[model samples]
Target: MRETPSTPAPRPIVGMVGAGQLARMGWQAAISLDIGLVCLGSAGDAAARAGAPLMEGSGRDGAALARLAAGSQVLTFEHELVDLAALGRLEAQGVVARPSAAVLSLAADKLRQRRTLDTLTGVEVPAFTPVTSIGELEEFAAAHGWPLVLKARSGGYDGRGVWICDDGRAAGQAFAEAAAAGLELYAEQAIDLAGEAAVLVARSPSGEVAVYPAVSTYQRDGMCRWVTLPASLPDGLDKKIGRLARTLAEETQLEGLMAVELFLTREGGLLVNELALRTHNTGHIHTEAAVTSQFEQHLRAVLDLPLGLTSPVVPAAAMVNIVGPADGSDPATRLAAALAVPGAHVHLYGKGARPGRKLGHVTVCAQTSEEALALAQEAADRLEGNG
Candidate 1:
């Protein structure tokens, strides 16, 4: 009888901090690669609910971070709200973290990112100033005009920690609130936006990079509502955006993925809006539309594996977010009805429903952008009881 060989042990685990929907998606990707994905997140996080291998801890806790690093060959983040100093300490101890703390720090601070982008050629960011008091805000507004945008330098997302001050009185009120909260603040000139778009790029430590096509995004009350893949832009504009994204990835020496948001001005120019250093909401459509999804690409990049093709398999794709309905009904309650929509690919985040909260999303791919958008919108509306 021939001797039987035992199966080899599984590949090294990739630890992710923050087990939200992004980490949950990463978990799914890891399964395909036959690797482990251990999430360091609160017990109640979406990934935990989805039965991911969870470490059950706060990302800010150094001990918890060390515990996660101990069990994994490499560490990456699902969110940028991590404790960078702690991550640095882990690096010193020889724990590998892709998009190292130095790179992640730039994304964690808005002011730092703004300053860095302002120095790069062909990059245009809004006129901004770090404001320490109401006087500084008034001065900025005086120079840049009224209706200025105020943002916390850190810890802001999904329409929170941002204020629009139309006058000195409003600026003063916003400044006072920020000061009370002990938040660093900055004032920016509000641009006349024709629309918004984003580019997702993945880079490996060996410097191999892949960039996805730019996608048009629609925002409602500062939260993304939908995205149309292969954004309809004038000839040559998409190439320019793709180049900018590649330049950013190379300049940052990025490992893993970066999503660059841009504001398309009414004057036909693009301005850098924000930077996200992990899987982003705008790239959700890629899961169903692209030849290789962003989540999988990110894992490959972080592991220094060959990057996958970034082209879309379909002609057009649209993704519509399922924000909780005003009545606060769960999307799960209507899951069957949503699934009934032809060609609809629904993804529920396993989050409790609350007004304006993101519960899930729907993506539809078709031969035309209009058809994809219509189908995705209908499916999302039906899930939210709006259809």
Candidate 2:
């Protein structure tokens, strides 16, 4: 008699820390892959709103992390603000945290990331120095020139924890504020920026890698507002940026998605600005524009599965962030109007409206970047009651 075959084991679950918009999108991708996503989010987070299974605690809590780990095969993150040392301990205890605690720690500290990348060949970073006190900031400014940029080495994002000081008095104020907040500060020479661009790359634990095209990012008030795919770069610049992203991924031993934000200097050279080790706002357009969305690619990478093609299905695509209006009215009230824009794809993070808060995003794909941008921006504006 022939022996009967046993049933296959269920797909492994991915435990994502911080159930923000990125985690919500990742959970959607997990659904299509027949995998599970256990989100360690607080009450009413985007992922929780999306009905993902919740671990229901702060990501910084060690016990919550352990519980999440116990029920999942892989641990990942939607945000990098976790307690790295505790996560490192979890890794020691056999939890598979893709991108690793070591990588997360390095990326979490801007000073460390800057120093490490500065030493890498073919990587250009703006001159930067650690600033511990007002005097140190002054000293760096004296050397680098006034109007320098000061950034907190940790806990800075979306324009917070960053300051521009044109004189000693301003530097002193910034230093005092940072000191009171217990933040590590660093000074950087502000580059004459032509524009900002970013490349999203995914690397699997098995050493497979895929890279998306570099995209132009437009910032307003230090937060990303719009991003256009196939950033108009000088000839050969795209390939050069692609190589840089791949090199960084290999050097970092990245096990999931990494977004390399680069500065296109006025001097016609590319400089590294920052690195994000998870899904990022820069790749938001990939959801409707590319063959494989960044969220899906991240899941595949973390699972050590075959990476997906990173090609654009359309000639051009653009993403526009929907910031909360000044009056703080809910954009959801205008959701129907936004959805009416032809070829526009809208994604709203389940959150209450607040001034300048990232409430959602709209993406549009078309034959030209100009058309995509116009449509995406129009749709985003409608969502915020600006159109």
Clash count, one per candidate: 0, 0
Candidate closest to the true structure, highest TM-score: 1
Per-candidate RMSD vs. true structure? 1.3, 2.6
Name every residue pair that clashes in candidate 2: none
lDDT of 1 by residue, 1-387 (tens): 998998988787899999999999899888899888999997789998999999989778889999999999899999888889999999998999988999999889999999999999989999999999778888888899988999999999987888988888888888888899999999999888888999999999999999999999999878999999879776788999999999999999999999999999888888999999999999999999998899999899999999999999999999999999999999889989989999999999999899999989999999998999999999999999998
Q: lDDT at 355 for candidate 2? A: 91
TM-score of each: 0.98, 0.96
Tens-digit lDDT track of model 2 for 290-316: 899999999999998899999999999
Best model number under lDDT: 1
